[model samples]
Target chain A: MTEGVALLTVFVLAVFVGFEVVSKVSSTLHTPLMSGANAIHGVILVGAVIVAGTADEAGVLVVALIAVVLATLNLVGGFVVTDRMLEMFGARRPEAAAKDGAE
Target chain B: MIAVWAQVCYVVAAVCFILALKGLSSPKTARRGNLVGAFGALLAVVVTFIAYDIDNLGWILLAVAFGAVGGAMGARRVAMTAMPQLVALFNGVGGGAAALVALLELSEPARAGITRPAGFGDDGWFAYSPLAESGGHTESEILRMVDLLSTGTLTATAFTVLIGAVSFSGSTVTFLKLQELMTGRPITFPGGPIVFGAVLVAAVGLGLWAVATGSVTLAIILALVGLLAGVLLVLPVGGADVPIVISLLNAFTGLAVAAGGYVLENALLLVAGTLVGASGTILTRAMAHAMGRSVSSILFGAFKGGSTAGGGEASDRPVRSAGPDDVAIMLAYARKVIVVPGYGLAVAQAQHTIRELVDLLEKRGVEVGYAIHPVAGRMPGHMNVLLAEANIPYEQLLEMDTANGQLRTADVALVVGANDVVNPAARTSPGSPIYGMPILDADHAGAIVFLKRSMRPGFAGIENELLFDPKTTLLFGDAKASLTALVSALKSL
Candidate 1:
């Protein structure tokens, strides 16, 4: 009803964009990339918020709130962990170089 | 309808996610790219709270805070060895959340601002009172509501719930397997495939029924069955292959979120979810290829009784055993060395010790590089993280192909706490489980020294034929202890 055709167009285009973006990644970045993408879907938090905001029943509200908690974990935990992993990749470079230089 | 400004904001957030993924692929911009994605996630969350007249604002904020603190703590505190488990757990919760949101949306149909029929929801659906009921409306109004509840949206909702539930349970099982809380070996039952197929067909059938009739009961049943299907899907996969399963489930969760986006009519969710779904699929395929297996074979291989069956018994074949000093002397005199690190190294927490030994080898003018198999530890890129934690230079880490080429000219292949990656069985024996897998050419080296706790076969339970090679020397001990001895032994030299 709400321009389903338009949404379908968006979906189709997004699929191609998705495939194109990550098509050339090296295997070394696979773990962090997976984790980062996992965090991005945590945007489902938006859906949880919208539903929780409108729920008039206690049962629905409780369930929506639980959804919020879980999505928050997925979102926040995913980013933090991914960042932590990338930090290892970033933080050690100079130190490693320094160690090499010292040796 | 979303406001123009909010729509623009969502678009911006979605673009950020794309850039984040692109940046994450390469090493140079990866950290900065993650930060950009985080900023976008923060922006989208803030915009949602502002754009919607959300009730229970205080409670929702509290829940957000509670989850944030817990997630950050867990992410920060987990050991590097358990990174795969943590990722699996976080992925599970995300998937579970998507399913629950879709379920809640199904229960509150009138929130879409349509009048429900009097007997509506009485037929085994969630029997909840409509949130905003308008007085007696015309037949046209009813028809309008029907138009709003298009088959398209309903179908998307059904897809969301089923796939989300599957991703949730599958990720949890993967986490358990990775954490060693459950047996890493494949678990199969009599008529397992038949039951799995039946339940899968039932889930798809129920999903179509839910879409056709808009029955919440059918949807709920579909979710339960989907959860069962997820568990059954991953149960037969052996431990070494669980990472691929996790990647596959990550893709599943992404597609579920994409469907949920369609149901909610949100462009940002649609785009972000689609990106993950697509990218995760490719990533899963790449990981499987790295292990020399197909996705289907990894899942159902145990049932076929081919890939995972092997004797766990330690081989009594006489392998030339050596002391740490002998191995150290071998390493100290070598002109070049390649170290093959694996899950055992991570398990024994010997990465730092190995790094120390590598450094000492380099100081002795012995060229050293780590031959990193794609699925090296529990997950792709796992050993890099572990070795990086130990301050090992990134330059010293070589991809499997590069390491293989170097192995031919190397004097010694010092395999520490690794078995399968260097196992020549992947190449020589067609009947072997890992026959087609691309293994590190450790056997190409002039001499091979293996550090082992025992003669136990690798995670696939397959024996390594290279162990019987006369050029191979076994130094029996814990990886850390053996590495420490080698480090000191080299120092004495």
Candidate 2:
């Protein structure tokens, strides 16, 4: 397979895989899940890194640097908030109640 | 050699990301799941630092350190109620970064040429830049990424810029409204659609012109226009619908990030970005479905605000007002009470009070449960999270169907600071903007005691007909204060 075709194939597969993985998330966890997904896309930092590494022009480097900082903020902040929020959901007290319908 | 090593690290990071998502499915493992995702991000960043040696590496390191500290502090300090706005802001910056990635990609080739080392010839996705200057001729040639940035890739870049601008600007509006920095009510100009249309047309027109003429200035102008269009698109949506807007913008950011991955030809970026896009699309749809709104209606509804939609004399209609003592007597006497909460509950920080009330009722042998409408809180499932913070057991939170079914036999449905969710207008009033929207059917209860601040209409600006029902009692005050009063009154009884 050609290089571009391989990437396209992976992209398509990831789309299906993502849908399958997220579809079963309980309603209560939706906010954390959305925020988690938000953080993962912060992987655009990969592109930012490539840009910062390759660009020789000061203008492009500055732009790339800005991308790196902003993407880092997104990655770090999104994950941290999601973690904090999910910690509230981590209690084991709710499981027995969850087994009953509308206790 | 470096490329191969970078790819290996990327593979490990990708596995971590997948495991992170799987862990998020169960609430018990959610925090751990977030940690796993963070580990993936850290791994990717470290790999990049090792593989790429840029000119200003020290400054990059400094900026990254500052960003990490700032982000950690901000996220840690934000109150739980302010989480929606914080997420909106963070989500916007991510999109902005992706857009910047496209710009840097465009400028890189114009400055210094990009070249791939040996062993990339068999790489399917590798495209060489055509602008490479002739060097020593050998049996093999290195491929530069800048050569691939031809007019053919302009469409991808334009798409990235457009989507990123929309997500950034739209989420900014979302943050402002959630933070109360902007009026949550829909704001409309006189020629609203026309103005929005003009901005959109200008963006598309300039974007194509930039692509055709290779004018970076026109491209930047197009991005600005796209930003204007984003604001216009969201300005007229009521605050209650902002969750749907935020969800949709999440999808937009995901797609833009995916485009950035394509521009950079990074498989990990592509996989992660596309995964987010897919999940975000599902989330947006689920949020819309919960409210019984079509995606288009939620986006296009020009909510006219409370003043215009509710000018009638529903306020003067003599509904029986019950004091806290009287409401407490009714609550104490009920065999089954169902509680319904909404955005007002969150705004008043009354979830803990509600929990106390439930405990008090349960001690008296009254079965108290929460009726959880799908779109009750600011975001989908937000109410569950909000209530969960109060340590309300998960089983007590009933979905709309189960709650409505139980309401048939319920002695009293106590609605706390909820307005539109329990409104019968969605069903009975065809002319209502929220017509055809699914509601909690609180009107089906044997008796409904509504705890509200006043006779004001809900976030949708439409009056709730259920408030006027003969069997309903209006217990007026702040939700937390009213609940506290009820607790005291019930205790005295």
Candidate 3:
């Protein structure tokens, strides 16, 4: 239970740190940023791993295996999609042919 | 010694995740930030494998293999327009995983006949340590295991399961709407608000019951009730409002992950999950604000589309319609043009064709730029991704406030399949649902050319007051075909 107190402290600090980190993301990149954040929550895949591989009963293992599969999908899909979207923003804008040409 | 190594790896992973988000604040470092997060994810999995005790590895390995293949295939196959839908589905998957992990943790003991301690899971509630020893006879160990089941842990299990259930089903509804497999129109029932209110209360009651009784059955029932509540949450939000709903549900998945971390007593999970939860919440509020609404209003407003006969009002409104040649002449001679992209553009799959038109206009010495509303398309930043895929420069994509200010000076504002953001009703007509929402000042352009399938109201189901302005000329037909025709017309001249 002493570890629970430590976990609580870590959780509380993360709440503030996390918000501060992403508060200034440009509106254009919001979707990819969100998808990136989605991948981060896949950290729970670790819990799924332990439960699926070593739980005493077949039922628990089966359910945990499903959880494992889902977490993997979310984790991998989230990062890949985010990377693909961000890749579009990196194309160097066709030699910067028009710099506020509309003005 | 191995414990120390695993803890160190976990710490590094947490830092990488923090850095990943911090870098995502700008486009310059976003990709690198993502790779860093991936590295962290891979490292976390490796470290866990080292630390986790396993009697069997075949099932876990198979699951990982299955996910990797499915994820890669989906990412490559999905069109840019469907990215939001894919993201929604991923959020649902993560939420489902969290809920299942909590449920399996609770159910394991009943099957194994562990009566006193309740959860004799793989590593038990506490991380297996050297102090645990071979003999499980210590009074303190017994008390600690009992405490894990009896009080605080049971509450966390209930919270995680319910939040996870809501995120899973709520995200699925958002996905369906984005995919157009279900109607994007708000599907509110009679007394919709009151119905949702009752469901919310019932869900809360169920959550408390699960905690009070520590009954797995109650928790499962509570999860089902939560699933119903999720569907109710997103069903009433119209297409224009679905972006915010997706963001809100993304936040819900984050909160559920954090709750799951508590149940597992894992600090890395605690940090990563809380960070995601906080980020999603902040983004959700920002999205809601951009719509000139509160989070609660967006969730419960039902959008309640105006019943004032859409056909009757549109019939009385006088609009000058034009052919491709007339639109081509207007666009060709304009000094500057602002192309406003919307959900319609995505639906028509006209992003590339519109980019071609912009290029033609550019070659003809007409300056071209895009006016991007914050809440454009199906999700936030949707237009930017679509245009970028067509290799449009990031510089030409102007924010709504900036573009609106420049609209007066621009000669032509070519609106392709967009309606709500350009609607003047947002600035006038207090009775309008989108009255206070910010809109692109397309009407201020010297001439306005609108591309549309028909005179249909935008997803908000509100009439575009801009369409009635004398400077606007409505061009009827598919967005891509109209633009392609306009390109040919310009080439002929």
Candidate 4:
């Protein structure tokens, strides 16, 4: 198989496994996990930018550029909003703070 | 040269995802895990940029700048109360983008020439050529006889686009309903079931047509039909089933994106999409179980408005009013206090004040814990998320199973802006609509202090028989103000 095909297969399988694992986790962890995964989606920005700059085809470049913008907005915006939510829940508990300080 | 490093970065990012998932299993380390996962993503992006073979940087830089601006604006403006709506919007955007990717694939010239294989043997699946035999390649006559076929990339792309569009539009509607921008009442037609069936059939027919003809236009039309179907499917579902619909739609979005990733041959996209799809599906099932409803029943919009009897009778029951001093006296000397939170707490935005009250009680050597019912608010796990925002310790936020066990042992059950979830009628009254539905056993507490706006029945439109019980006392007013006054009275005592 070609290198691209190999990469694609690995990614698909990994996603399937990842989904299985995430599904088993307690409901309490859903928001935090999503928040984390969303942040990681920011990587799509770099990929988009790269694809946009390298593609000789103008249409492909335009779409790639657009993807980059959307993905980045999703990434940065999602994190900031989520962090603010965490803060609203109240300042960290004394025990949590103590642990943080120790670390 | 940089491709090697980019590949390494992808590997590292994947590992981070695994670790993050592991960390998210427990609340204690969730934040740290999230941070680690984010860093991994950042590393992957940066590495990809460095390895990119680009001659022109200006346009790419411009796109990046635009994204930065948009991200900053949205992050700064949106409030915590609207976070769920914002999440829905973001999920929609993701699905939309995936659909756009599919659309772009369809526009590719090379894709237009692709056609379904003529036939297949007894296996009933088409086999693509591993090699191009030059001129005069012999076609298998037997293979041509059987019309067994496999859907090609274009057909897959079209399906992805259709499903993604539907998920996007449907999620937007759900978000609007939750934000109160749209009415929460189920929009049902006279022949709702028949309409739903017709739409389902049409959607399937369109899918088949697109596959057989390899027509992008036909696929686009199918997408529109699916989009309409999505709205129709969710419209007749009542407020009670909104949470389940949200979960189910979320799963749909994930699956759609996964299909898009397959069309685009993107590894990261596939992985992320599948993760979201699977998790959302499980959560949907769990939510259905929590509500004592089947997934099929939820889909068919079997449950809509609340029972009629509870609302009128609940308003007629006499409520005993309590002053801050009365509340303070009861709470000040309490050995164990359990706070039951409901939709009113969310409405009053009183989570912060409630957290403060918990702290004050702990300071006075009183044990305070929160009792959270599974479907306490507008969504599943709503109370936990709200309490978490107020920095309530994960341990203090007790689930119904755990909290129910401790209600009888408590000195007082201070119900803050709560209703139906604490109703004893559900367990005792066999004729009641909500009978057999598990609730927090707040009625069993030595004393119950309920702080609500009025003696209104909860979202389920059923009277909480607990309100009329001798053990219960109602403190009427805004939850925030009531809690503030109660806090001061406790301080004075």
Q: Pick the candidate with the highest lDDT.
A: 1
Q: Each candidate's chain B TM-score?
A: 0.92, 0.90, 0.91, 0.82
TM-score: model 4, chain A: 0.56
> Any residue pairs clashing in model 4, and if so which?
A15-B271, A88-B389, A89-B389, A89-B390, A89-B391, A90-B389
* B274-320 per-residue lDDT for model 2 (tens digits): 87888888877777777777788777753553434553224777788
True contacts kept of each: 0.81, 0.71, 0.75, 0.38
Model 1: per-residue Cα lDDT over B269-324, one tens digit each: 88888988998999899888888899888887542565555557788888899998
Model 1 chain B weakest 10-residue run by lDDT:
B118-127
lDDT for position B135 in model 4: 27
lDDT: the better of candidates 1 and 2: 1
Q: How good is the docking of model 4, by CAPRI class?
A: acceptable
Model 4 local distance difference test score: 0.66
Comparing 1 with 3 on DockQ, the higher-scoring candidate is: 1
- For model 2, how does the per-residue alpha-carbon lDDT over A21-73 read when each residue is reduced to its tens digit? 77876666777888898888887877787777765667777788888888888
How many backbone clashes are present in model 1? 0
* DockQ, model 2, C-alpha based: 0.46
User: Cα-based RMSD of the predictions, in order?
Assistant: 4.1, 5.3, 4.8, 6.4
List runs of model 1 lying over 4 Å from the truth: A93-103, B110-148
TM-score-wise, the better of 2 and 4 is 2
* Candidate 2 Cα deviation (angstroms), residue A36: 1.3
Q: What digit string (tens of lDDT, one per residue) describes model 3 on residues B113-225?
A: 33333332423534432233424335553443344465567777888899899999999999999888998777877987798889989988887766665567878898899
Best by DockQ: 1
